[model samples]
Each structure stands twice: as structure tokens, then as C-alpha cells.
Target: MAALTGLLFLGAMGTANAADGFQTSVPSAILVDYDTGSILFEKDADKRIAPATLAKVMMADVVFAQLRAGKIALDTPLVVSVNAWRRGGGPSGGAAMFAEVNKPAPVGELLAGALVVSGNDAAITLAEGLGGTESQFAQMMNAQAQAIGMTNSEFHNATGFADAGQVSSARDLATLAAHIIRTFPDYYPIFAKPNIEWNRIKQRNRNVMLDAGIGADGLQVGWLKDVGYHALVSAVQNGQRLVVATLSARSEKERVEETRKLLEWGFQSFRQRQIFAADKEVGRAQVFGGAQSSVGLAARGPVNLLTPRSGGERVSARVVYTGPLRAPVTKGAEVGRLEISRGPVKVLDVPLVTTEDVAVGSLMDRAIDGGLTLMGDSVRDLARRAMAKLHK
Candidate 1:
């Protein structure tokens, strides 16, 4: 709720459990609609837990960002450090790509190993290549997580191996998976690959949603002796895509079965619909000392989301900004945000831009608006203070 502060809210406010009707055995799980960034379902979605190999998705994303920015090419050769080899390779009793020590593994192979096989060696090599060391790379991971709004996650190492402090939530991992799909379509297919061969060792990918007949393309799976199993998976049905993250399952069967159930339920229950057109006015905002008292607002693109196929859900929309904006507003300039929700769950929070320009108003208009704003501010401030006291 702290994230909702400082912005105007024009939607209904209340506290209700998200995805209340559905139940599952996994301790932390989330279902997200890929297109509209909606939370279709969630249970303990934000409770921090060790994600184990699921953290490789974050490591992979960092490398993807670097590749997209032209910082490194797929063909660039990365050295496999002894530290990476001994700790993340075959000797560690963890998943490994088995790259030879002192040999240079190409960036492309490392990406595939990390994503397809969940190879710690491949992940560590990429971390060292991109950030010079695993510890430093963890800092970069934390930075990227914050940039992308994975607020509850923190990374202590690139391999998801560290003190208990290395942690992420199911919601954050799902966000990471969607971020990969949306930002790196070229590399995203690596997750869907069935297997990868390195050092003459071939390992079948653990994420077998494709074989499960659930429309899963690629993602990850993990197990820790005491921490249980976790998976971050995505699936598509009839061209609609959804991401599901399940953490701390009791066994391999539960991890797969529970995730498949959530994905199928989401696909069956929702249909995508365009609620607002790209150029049409979404709402309006007051403009002080301008040619007009208010300016029309529109989204940069069409607003679409997975609405219940049966319809008639209690949906609400909001416009957020600190206004009345003073003078000379330009058309297409961003001024606020539009947030839409169903029941108490957030759906979309998109940018809002001015629909038309408004030039500066006359001196008399400015004076009047200033006086009115002063009075309004005082009244709003008093009300805000009272609300703060109540909150305390």
C-alpha cells in the first residue's frame, strides 16, 4: 500500500484477500496475466523465501539486458573461473554445465546452460563475465530487481547459493519471467529448449511443461533438501499467455501438478478485452492557470486485460497525479497514471498523457486559480493529516 501513496486514487479502496476462492498446497504462489500485468490469483505471493535455482531467471535476465544493450555479444567468450568451476560445476553436488576450467565458454552457451539446465556453473560464469564477480553481480541483480519493481527480493549470489539472506518471493520470480519474455523475445526461447549439451554431458531440462501438455514453453525448477521445491513457469492457451510461480512445494509431483492447475484455471476463467482505445480519452485532470480548467487524458496504447469470461466482476479504474498542473500543458506529455482493479486486486497501472495542449491562461485567470488552489490545498491538507492520525 505504501506504493500507492503520493498519487491520487480514483478507484474503490478496501481490503480483501486476493484469489480467495482458489486453494493450493504450495506455500507461496502467484498467477499473473502477461498482457495487462494483472494479478489473477495469489497466495502469500510476497512472502520472501529462498528460490534456489529459480534465481537463475534473474541471472539470465541481467545477461539478457547486457546483450540487448550491445554490451556483450552472444559470441563473446567468457572465462570459466576455477571458483565458478569448483563451487558451481560438478564438484558442488549441484546442477552444472560442466564447463572446463580456464576454458572460455561462449556467452550463448552459458545463457542456454543457465536457463535450460539451471546450471550453476553457467550462471556463475555469466555473472563474472557481466559484473566481474558473483558478489558484485548480486548487487547488479538487486539493482535490476528494484528497477523492475521486484520490491521484496534480494540476491546474495548469482547462483542462488548463499546464506539464508539470498531470497525472493513467488511474485518477483514471476515478474522476472514475464520481463524476460517481454524484453528478450530472441533469447526467451532458450528457456523452452528441451536440453543442452556441454562437456559432452547432456541433461534434459527440468521444466517439462511442454511435455505436460500445459502449453509451457520454458522457465525453471528447483529443489533443496530442507527448502522443498519451487518453479516459475509460463503457459499459453488460445494465444493468451500467463505466468505462474510456485515456491516451497513438498515434492516434485506437487510442484508440477500445482503449477499446471493454476495455469489451466487462469486460462479457463479469463478472456482478454480492450477497455480503452489508444487515442481515446480515459479521463480528465484539472489544469490550473491554463487556457482550460481541465485537460483530456488518454493512454499511450490500448488498455486490455483478462476479464472474467462470465463478466460482471466488480471492476474499478483510477487516475493518479498531483494537480492542478500549472500552465502550458503539451499534448502527449505524460502527467499521471491510470490504475485499474477488479475487487481489491490490481490489474493495470499505465501512464496517462495529455490529450490536448492548453496554453497559459490570462493574468486574471491565474490569480483566481491561485486563490482557489490555496484554499483547496489547506482543506485537503487538514483532511490528509486527520487520515494520517487515523493510520497511526
Candidate 2:
């Protein structure tokens, strides 16, 4: 049985198809489907690079978590610490909210400063207020990164100030952006605010996509002397939301152009096709010890795929399971996987679960089924060996 399952797994390792014709100057980039977590296009997406102000996204995430837990309210006042003042303030020579030292600001205004204007001081102030110190707040940032499965991220500060070990990946940033969008939707609107008034300084948002007439709503942008310009831009069109992350572009204009190209390609190049509805039978699996000889298998939710719009290639699907399955089987138990492919390229794979339970068969029925299972196993072994030889 184990060998048969291995063979089945090998058989299901589907082929790959290239998403060609799209290119970008950004060294690291990724475009993902917000609904399905599908990678439409990527370039060195996992390579860790300085996230610069993009780290504020995670900083905002930590603050949003506190807000959701009721530990702090939007109007909660936080005083600017000396560390926040000296490093992230006007003296730091970076973007700042120009917050006065020892002056208190509301959590809502601080968030606006940090997100809309990329204020390093507001980020540090929020960090210190929440975590007692910037160092401790960095610990919280790392812990949150782990919780959210940002495998290639590390944080040394909330302000995203250049540090020795501070780095993140485009893919990880996309995941973080998606998480923020899904988790704190009530607070997400602040990212789109064009500018915020704090300490009498009016700074416009650095995100150019908002002004480009694209469906872009809210997200973060990052830039550093050595790291160049990076942007995590998301847009919605016709109910479809897509997030694009770019790192190390030559200039702000170049980053914006590259990100826009990726978004346009993603929206214009692919069309979604619904393959299976929730709880709808996709196929059947043979059951050895159940009263019935076979059980229906279905998808837990609607299965959809984004396929090339040209429509020249045919899409195929197969249900792969280790069988004959022994009863009793419970409904909704994951029994197999559904693999969908366009031509030779596998596009989507989802679990195939039993739609109904199967009860144990009678003693005589079990005996008959047991003998048939042995015979079927022998045939499967031969077929597996034949297939292996053909591959060689």
C-alpha cells in the first residue's frame, strides 16, 4: 500500500508552463491573487532585501492587533520618547511626522502618520508605547512575522531604519499585505488617505498608484539609500484584488512603472474559470470494507483557476487517492487531491474529501472485499512497475 501511494504521488507531480512575455527591472517582485493565493508572476521573490519603510506595514499590523484586542483604542495617546525623537524625528534626515519631543499623539493620528506619510517618528512612538522600547517592539515584530508565516523576514526596528540584520522578501511582504487587508479591514482605509496633518506638517503619501486612476486603495512604500525604491501596491478591478510587491528598483518612477505593468498584465492576461462548486462531487473512490463499493468525493469550496486568456490550451483534471479505501469513512474526511492542469502545466491543486460516510460491511462482505483488495493490489503493483520502467 505504501509503495502504491508513493507511485501515485509521483504520477501526480504535474508539469510546468511558463508565464512568458512579462518583464520588470525590479530585482525582486511578486504578483499574487488575493482570493486564491496564486502566484501569477514572480522574480526572485524569496530573496531577502532591506524592506526600508515597508517594515511599517508590519508595525501597523502589530498596532492593529492591539487595537482589535481592545488593549488600546484609536484615540489612545502615546508620548514621543527621546529615542523616537532623535532617530526618527527631523534630525534623522529621513521622512518624519516632525513630532515634538515629549508631545503626545493619538493612536489614530500616529497610524496615519506612519502609513500615509511614512513617518519614522510616529512608527517608533507607536512601537515604544506598545512594547515599552524599540528593541522589545522588534521582538514583537519578529514574533508576529513568525505567526503569519513570513519565513524570510527579520526586524531590527519599527521605523525600518537601515540596520545590519533587517531584511524581508517580496513574497513575504505580499503575504503580510494580504494579511493586513483581511485582518484589519476597518483600519485599512487609512492607507488611502492622501495626507495627514500632524504637528502642522502636511506630507503627501508616497504611493503614486493612488493618483494614477488605478483601483489602488491603500498599502506601504519603502526606500533606502542602498536598497533603492520598493513598493507593495494592491488594486481591485471588477471585484478581483491583486497585490504587487517590488524591491530594489532604480528609481521611484521605475518602481511605479514596473508595478503598474505587472498589475496590468495580471488583470489583462488571465481569466478565472470555475472548475468545481463547493460540496459538488468531483469523482469517486473505491471502498473495500464499506457496505457500498465506492464513495463520492468533493471539493470543500468552489475550485477556480486563473488561466491564460488566449484559450488555446485545454485544461484537464484528475482525482488522485490511495485506494481502495477501507471503511468506515466519515463525511468531509480528506481522502485525496484534485489536480488541475492546463496542457502539461499544473495550475491548481485542492483536497478531495468524502461527501458521505461509509459504514463497515458484514463479515462475509468484508472477507470478499479483502480478497478483491489483494487482487487489485497485485494489478496496481504491476502497473506501477510498468510505469516506472517507461519513465526510465
- The root-mean-square deviation over C-alpha atoms between each candidate and the true structure, in angstroms, is 6.7, 6.7
lDDT (0-100) at residue 87 of candidate 2?
90
lDDT of 2 by residue, 58-102 (tens): 999999999999999999999998989899989988888889999
For model 1, the local distance difference test gives: 0.82
TM-scores, all models, native as reference: 0.88, 0.79
Whole-model lDDT values for every prediction: 0.82, 0.83
Number of the predicted model whose lDDT against the real structure is largest: 2
Candidate 2 clash pair list: none
